[model samples]
Target: MGWLLMIALAALVLLALWKVAGFGRLGLQLAGAALLLAMAGYAWQGRPALAGRPVPPPARLELPESAFAQTREAMLGAVDQASFWLRMADSYHQRGDTYSAAAILRSGIRAHPRDPDLWVGLGNALVVHADGMMTPAAELAFNRAAAIAPEHPGPKFFYGLALAQGGRFDEAERVWLALLARAPADAEWRPMVVERVQMIEQLRAMQRARPTR
Candidate 1:
């Protein structure tokens, strides 16, 4: 579309310049056409990533049965009822209503303060919130969750993401790289770590470009 527009506009400019028979006017007209062509070229080059993604059949995510045990033990026997809050929390999450999800998570945490799962859920909500303060909340949540389930990878990943988002790049790299080492060989998150590594490299490039004192 942009290419067509650029061509039509260039043709119109050339035609007008031809009718006027002024070399000076033609040069200016050609310059304007050149600018339009450059813009068209840029937009044409950028259109693919903007296209919507094709639907994918849900891939079966295989974690250990220990995953359920970890999550359940974190609930301290209240796992069954926790679903009530989770159902509502998920609705809020789906709508991008993180505040409500965070509130529900907080309510669940308060009701079961020792429940590691609820604490982590609340922390996850805060991390994902549009207005969330990542530094303090993610720090607290991941710390608590990790303290409770030191062997689990989920909280550690969240912690790394939180650190990255908060500009703690070195720490985030350490956490994520360690996770990549221990993660299941074919786990989806290993690819995610690759993406995060790319992000960190971009940030490092920008940092190197800055005037450092």
Candidate 2:
């Protein structure tokens, strides 16, 4: 908004100079129109308002056309049926199609039990479906993947997420601390770990303040 205001002011000065150079009243009118448009655009952007209540940017959908496009491209030259199934599962996962994603990954796993990626995908799908139930199924799926590829971070992260979402904060804390220890000090997941730890502390404090049930 500030930049737009500067540009509009500059244009206004130029317009005034051109009008003074005998360009006629028509050039002045066009300059006035341009100034109004720039000012209107700046106002609509809502960054500098006298009222002090800035409007927020538009909310965007979680799943968008580009994610779908990527899925389409992934499917185009899939090496095998398993690859195609996995790509389709990824598309379903991106769209929050947990059941479909799990089913597809399960099929891929049944076809190729040795595929660590398939197991990891299945585990992630199960975690998504777990929501609040924290069912034994999700635990088993993650455990299976972790057992197959114990060094893989994907299963561990999902397991920690599942523990956190299930409200087992103590267990989640232990798991996340362990993950952070294994993960690099400057891992990209550091912020997420910090935030989750803060959330856990806040919730625990709230629980302590509540009356006994």
Candidate 3:
């Protein structure tokens, strides 16, 4: 679908150039067409990874299973509304297709750019795609989410998770500490964040104790 749209668009652009310019300065017109075609080719080459195979069969992804729903009430006000697409993305992540998961979230962002939850979802997927490493791209996603929804706890929590996964426990702890301080006492995700902070502390201690070979 995406490719076909791009091809159609390229043809339209070429046709418009032909009709408007009438091949006057034919070299420039041909160059424009060539550039459009090249772009289409590049998009097609990357389509497989960008729009990969179908995500895991649709299923209700639970909270504790992936920690995805931990901050559900805070993030999107609940799990069943616009967050349904987010759950689908999480399902892909659970099934080990982080690329597809990220792609789905990206599509969601394109339609709803201001939705911080989608940005956080993309960040989470990127973290998984990097094998628990928080790559720069993942960081950017988190930052975008945070910038868009400065008061939202989802971005901070997931950014911290990514840091912990990348073995940057101290950074993760700091992020989580700030989140905990601001998080409502009755918030459903507070306990989960506390649990993860404790886990990170323990992991940091162990890493410190392991003497270099």
Best candidate per TM-score, number? 3
| Clash list (residue pairs), candidate 1 | none
* The best candidate in terms of lDDT: 3
lDDT of each: 0.67, 0.66, 0.78
lDDT (Cα) of model 2? 0.66
Model 1, range 1-213, lDDT digits (tens) per residue?
Answer: 756876797777666766675547668667776867787678767675476989997654332222222343332335565667765676776665667877998888778776666666666667666343464765697789878877666677666766666567898899988988887897745676777778898989998999978
Off by over 4 Å in 3: 1-65, 69-77, 184-186, 206-213
RMSD to native for every prediction? 17.3, 18.0, 11.5
> Where in model 2 is the C-alpha error above 4 Å?
1-87, 90-97, 209-213
Estimate, for each residue in 87-179, the C-alpha lDDT of model 3 and write its tens digit.
888777766667788899888888888888888878877877787888898899999999998987778988987798788888999999999
**Model 2 residue 202 CA deviation in Å:** 2.6
Q: What does candidate 2's lDDT look like per residue over 1-213, in tens digits?
A: 677667778676766668667656687777667777876786687565456678897653354322222332222223355466767876776676668878998888888886655665565567666654457777777788788878755556667666776678788788877877887777655666667677888999998999996
TM-score of 3: 0.60
How many residue pairs collide in each prediction? 0, 0, 0
Which of 2 and 3 is the better model by TM-score? 3
Candidate 2 collision pairs = none
RMSD of 2: 18.0
